[model samples]
Target: MILKDCQRAALEHIRQHSAARREVAQETIAHLLEMSNIAQEDFPQALSSIQSHARVALHFHPDRLSQNLTSVADLLLTDGLYKNQFETFLSNGALSPDKGGYRDLWENGMFGEVYMTAHVTPSDRPKYGALNLMLLPDGPSPRFGSCYFLLKPHVLPRCTFSSTGSQLNPPEKGTLDTLDGVLAALLTESFYREFALGVHNIRTRQLIDHLRDNLTKPFQDPSTQAAARNLDYFIEVQVHGPIWLADDVEILVADPSFKRTKTGMLLEKICEGYDIELFWHCGFVLNVEEVPLDFRGPKMPSLARRVASGTFLDVEMIGEAAADLKRHPERWRDRGPYEYVLQELKRLWHVLVKFGKPNNTQK
Candidate 1:
């Protein structure tokens, strides 16, 4: 089927399975459909005209959505601290905690910002948030890391209807690269948080083993860290999520004595402000794989844009999450709306180029 047709089918599925979810699903699917159309209109030869690094706009389940949120957070955080030696870098004033600032996805709904929120409450509101379209260039480069990523509230924004349509919301954009110092601090904290929280949970901690396995010479390459480009600015969208910190975060963070660094002190303060489960949502365009034309959405139902679910609120509930995943692994892989639109477009293009042939030599 065509890309638009696929979207139509998904919309129909949502309509039948759940009506209240129809509107938001419509909004998301419609927004993406419109973007696909715009890309084609703007480029004429959509796929080829599109740059490899072009900003593409685009969410998921609570256990699933929340997992995506954390992974995105990890992508931004780890990307920020990729090369810095975590050991004495902080004390050397290389990365100061005072640098980075957090933009609440709930408040500053901009396009292109690497952030996303999973509504743990309502099962179908809107999974994707605004993409930060502003690109002023901050420095540091993608080769350096997630310079602007910071931990903020995980709460979903209040859904409001506007006839304004899907204009790329570019929030106050100046420099995302300059926040590296601040992002380093949060990334440091996340590493430790994962480590500490994992000590009490098996599955969460197993993440450490995975990290350690991948630590040597790209062993963990498949587990995370997708690929790269010729320039140092080239970076692969690294896969990251909750993992057990069986050892100090220094293992992945590279900071030997992190608890004593200035970052460590700052992390303590940041943790005090929000509930323990709170995390910053990050969304960004990256060098990604060509998902299959027949890519199936994850197995879960759509999530409502409501409050964060209390089910996975505390570390204590980590066990519950593991059980949920173990019991029904299928639900965890439900195809997301963003993936559907993206892959379907590629599929549509393939179909046309193969059967809808035309002369290339100016007949």
Candidate 2:
């Protein structure tokens, strides 16, 4: 049968199947196709239509949990059209020996990783995910970060973060004093309870409130203040959370001297009795100083153009591809099929990026 026929049959089958079953089928097909020789361009219109229809149908489906899973998959497959390109670029960049396992650094001339994953539900199998937080001279620049929580469909609820943390250090005169104060304040009865309970909910707003309430208090003991000042730098806490389909949270600090081991230990102690994984990643900032002037074309655009186009899909794709490569490197052992997908994705990205740019006629 032709591609159109195949797609029609697939859609029909999906309509008849339960949401969970449809997701399993979709994932299986995605894996099979990843190793196939099919060209992406041949079915752009079809893919677009199927994805759109699936999205609407999923929203109205009876199985809310399964619908959410399928919706996320659909969005990953089609939404933010540039997602594929971003993934391809990041994958190639990360694996490139010259770039030293960093994708954004190689292609975009910036350094950072976008953390992501597919299996959000807690499983005995290693929960698939990625971490792309790179430390920079100015501080930690989380270009595109994501974390997934594994919870059943009926029990799952959407969560959101109120405000992100800043890398900017507080004033100098009070830097040492502030750091000491914040650390001690986190130990107060009220502060400790809020931090423990709020983090469990994995709500960004609650975390921020907990941090603000606890992190701003002054230290009363002189000995503790001295010890805090002796430390190289104060931990700058940036909160990220309320990830859909997953109970997730992240704390990023701007201090280059921040020790991952120490931070992890401290967090574990602070969160003693809480049931969550507190990951600690340390790396320097990866900033794109410039997009090669000549690189601006159908494939790559000026920062301004990219921003105007709002190609979030592309950014997401990069994260997804990166996560897949990290989680399942064995699946892509034969590089040929992966290369084919990457090239085709690049061509598509070029075309899509230029879809609506104003033509220059005053030459």
Candidate 3:
């Protein structure tokens, strides 16, 4: 099936399954279908144009949304520290609005800024807060993170929509290089983060053993390997309800040493805000592998050339590569010669291209 057909099918599936959800779900999906149609018209080379990394995620909490007066912005405004990070980042100028501030996504809703030039990463310090910190955890260490503005429900879409660079280079620079790379990276990271969260639930020794097993496992099946080589792109439309802290967070808060620490204190404040079971309303992943690729490379940025011909890393390879970086930080630490810093930056850039299938396998 074609990319547009796949997207239509997924939307139909959601329409059939989303009756239990609030009206927000229906509204958001309708907007998405509109956007898809617009994309086809906007890009003449729709079959081969670089697929934009876009998704709409629904966020709802029963208690939080119960009162008609309790707006999303209101909740963030009143909620103690942790939940207010998004607001703090904007107000303090740590993050600025994108060139075009707010454009209407629909009659009632608007798409917000891209914040910093970079894509957000899940915090290494999960105990601190459920914050998706922007950029790598390098430099002066940004205190707050970037997330969607919590607009009120009536005037709000009740969803956050984001479009970011696939791969290419840091600060989410997009090019033909991101075509397959972006899709692979997003799916791999999502699954990896989810699995790592599972590790936090299990015993440390058991988790280590599991990782060890994963490390040792080889790509045994020929057919599976071939399938992995073929690239696919999809939008993971999802409705996430409520928010809850993990057990490890609670244990850490119990320790006086941890309680007094910065991350712990912030986490404690976040924990104080909400406690409920995790909920999700499934959407769908539409296959866009059939989309064509025929962009001119010479007109692209100089940096795009670097990623155009290299071997793109796989999911397991990315995990292993990341673990190696953590284990040996000194290799890239401390500034030295100009050439050395530039080389290290390039190396880090390659490491950061965390999406899609390897270029060698591109079909």
Candidate 4:
């Protein structure tokens, strides 16, 4: 998809103040245009179309939440695009590791782990909806960085997601108003209510305290307690990069780390209290390096094609596919044109970020 006049000007404006490397954004935009033939005017519909066909993963750190459960709104940048109190910590480079942003120390060299995690965690999942989160399995790898909230059709807009990542600056002050129709939904009171209620339902103070008490250190010192209370509020309604979910998306938990485990039991208890249906998947995803190529070009295998064509509606099919793969691991595992689907989907995501409504509001 080629960028329109307003889209081109928007990118140019972002480059002027954005901490994101200019070349990185430029290359991402160029690559996506080359990969997708979708028209510029069709981007909004294309955004929903791609996600409708893929599984979405919402990653989170359980231990960190256990310490101080906060809203997705709480995790946004305060400095660069949406200046507020939270960005104060980011600009000062005072953010803790668990909070997952860069300090001045490494801000120049690397993107925030929070944004990077969102990047590496592909929006595309197999038709069975199994996720290759950070290309690692469900156990205790640095890759999990956080656990996930897997859903079939995610609620967040594609325009909020960057195929690369966004830049975070210090106290620069920005707003989603520029993104117009795209992010205007985000700033609405209904959106704020959805976020607050969702987080409150998923992890309450009681749950946080329970998880914290179980932690080896507990972090109950007076100073830590004070900080936790202060950090708990939702000061600004902004998306630093991506807003992972809305209240309606069904939650799925599929980690061996959550199966028969203490945390898993607690999670189930929490879901039960909220009347939330928590589904499960086989705990592994078929991992591969790159997309497979064929005579016509790249292609996805049967299951992925089901997802891409928007026919993957039977939730039972998820378990069925998982069971078959488990029974015949040699034949059906790690052998698909999975990366091809991911690349094609990302073509839409990159276009959404560059020229879609949220970022290209000038039009």
Q: Taking the tens digit of each residue's C-alpha lDDT, what string does model 1 give over 1-363?
A: 122322233233322333433344334433433533433132222212111112211111112112233322232233332121121111111122221322224212332222223321111212222111111121112212211221111111111111112222211111121212212222233344542111222222233233233212211211122212111111111111211112102111111112333333333333332222212212111111222234232211122101113211111122133334445556545533433332322232222222221111110
Tens digits of per-residue lDDT for model 4 on 1-363?
233333333333433433434344334433333344323334333333333432244433232211133321233211111122232221111233333344322322222222233332221110101221111222112122223443433332221222211233322211221222211222232222432211233212222232223322211212111111111122111122322233323443433334464445655654554444564423322212212333124433333343221432121223233334434446443444433333333222222112211111111
lDDT comparison, 2 vs 3, better candidate: 2
Highest TM-score: give the candidate number: 4
Question: Among all windows of ten consecutive residues in candidate 4, which has the lowest summed lDDT?
Answer: 223-232
Look at candidate 2 and tell me the lDDT of residue 336. Answer: 39
Better of 1 and 2 by lDDT: 2
CA error at residue 285 for candidate 3, angstroms: 38
Q: In candidate 4, how many Å is residue 250 off?
A: 2.9
- Candidate maximizing lDDT: 4
For model 1, state the Cα shift of residue 66 in Å. Answer: 12
| Per-residue lDDT of candidate 2, residues 189-280 (tens digit) | 12334432112322223333333343223212221111111101222221111122222322222111122333234334422323433322
- Candidate 3 per-residue lDDT, tens place, 1-363, comes to 122322233233323333334244334433433533433232212212212211121122111121233423344335431222122222211122222332111101211111222332211100112111110111011111111212112211111111231111122111222222222233234334432221223332232234334322321222122111101122211111221222111111111112233423433444455331211111111112311133222211232322232333222222232233334446534444433433333333223221132223312
In candidate 3, where is summed lDDT lowest over 10 consecutive residues? Answer: 133-142
Each candidate's root-mean-square deviation in Å? 26.2, 25.3, 19.9, 21.0
Error of 1 at 93 (Å): 33
